[model samples]
Target: MNAPITIDTPRTRISALATDHTALLLDYRLRNRDHLAPSEPARGAEYYTEQAVASRIAQVEAEAEAGSALHLAALDRASGQLVALCSFTNIVRGPFQACHLGFSVDHAHEGSGLMAEVAGAGINYVFDQLRLHRIMAAHMPRNERSAGLLARLGFEREGYARSYLRINGQWEDMVLLSLVDDRPGA
Candidate 1:
């Protein structure tokens, strides 16, 4: 097993997703199914099962080892409950050191700045530890909250895409945004 990467904050801790996290992830997904459905692609009934989550955890772990992706889970400090998920996917090296960023917070934790804390920590890992050059994120134009969050995190709007992805069974448009590492040597 790979060593877990953990980042600590005042209210939460962000850690690399591991197989041991299967149960917590499964519970979080099942509990937030309806709350997250609109923002996510439709999933089959099997997707929520513990077995499926375990399989996904294994796949992500392998991807992390292969340097193609990283998945982080944010847990409440006090309760140790899984409260958010963040990922840097499709990482590209060589001349293009970048990846797509994706994240979501549990419904009960929304509007509480938990995601901001978690995402900040995760982005730091991507740029500092992983040494990625850029992180791109996209959200539906209607998702004002996500737009605001990305702006606050220093991601600049790049463009708009029509029918960018299939979400909840229909094609959805997305506003593209990206943040480049501006530190020296980045």
Candidate 2:
């Protein structure tokens, strides 16, 4: 409920998306659609349409406004351009103060450790500032890079979900990874 977490990097920062950032958001989403497609099979060229993107943006903002979840936009600190996105979604408050974490980086920025850096910052905010106990990441088994990043970030492989979600048009399995706040008695 505190201000949404802002992640700062040497060259960029990740902050909540403002409605006025439509242009940047659309560009980021469209530009990264290819890089993100493999991981997010549900996305397609049609999915990147402005109407669809705007609807999703509205949904995210509504969720944030309702105290349900937070969506942070990764911006190049120098140019002030959106390059990526990371979000905590489907948040449940109360005893289950937890949510699903998901992200995508512009292909131009991949292999630069930017995703991991952003994730570390976002996870810290969820655990420390938001006081959440757990953040879950689900990825397809074929996404070796994503799995590796989760492991490197200290998230444990929790389990596997069969047909966890629909990717593109087919049901796919997901490897569930979790990061827990193990701070003494936390």
Candidate 3:
């Protein structure tokens, strides 16, 4: 397996999720459940349990080892609190070197640009280290904050899909966006 990646920003440290971080992840998810409900699907009771989080961490670690996914957490430098989560999921190699990105920031850290900071680092790793060609992100039409963040990350609007995903128990329309690695020979 590749060495764990860590990116230190001005205010936070973004590191690849590991089994040891399961408790922190569970705490962050539980604390932000209400804040994230509008944008995320409802989680089952077990989702908040330590056992489930540990299993998830193990699965994510396995996927990272297999080159299929990268899951990272942004933690506050001083407080050691999880501030955001970023994931490059469903990674496809060979000719289709791309992945779908999913992310969310803690409510307490919203509008602080921490998500952008961490996501930028994650994207760099995806492009430079992983040598992926494209990264795609989708957001509900009403999610202005996500749209703005994606724009700042240089993603272009690709299209829109009706009922692109189920969120909060209902089908949500999504605006699809993608960022292509334009570096030479990428």
Rank by TM-score (best first): 1, 3, 2
Task: Please tell me which predicted candidate would have the highest TM-score against the true structure.
Answer: 1
Expressed as tens digits, the lDDT of each residue in 23-118 for candidate 1 is 999999998999999999999999999999999999999999998999999889999899999999999999999999999999998898888889
lDDT of 3 at 82: 92
Candidate 3 structure quality by residue, lDDT tens digits, 20-110:
7988999998999899999998788888899999999999999989989999998899999999999999999889999999999999989
TM-score to native of every candidate shown: 0.97, 0.91, 0.96
What TM-score does candidate 1 get on C-alpha atoms? 0.97
Candidate 2, residues 84-149, lDDT tens digits: the string is 788888888799888999988889888788888887888887787778888999989998888888
The 10-residue segment of model 3 with minimum total lDDT is 1-10
Scored by Cα lDDT, where does model 1 land?
Answer: 0.93
Give me the overall lDDT of model 2.
0.82
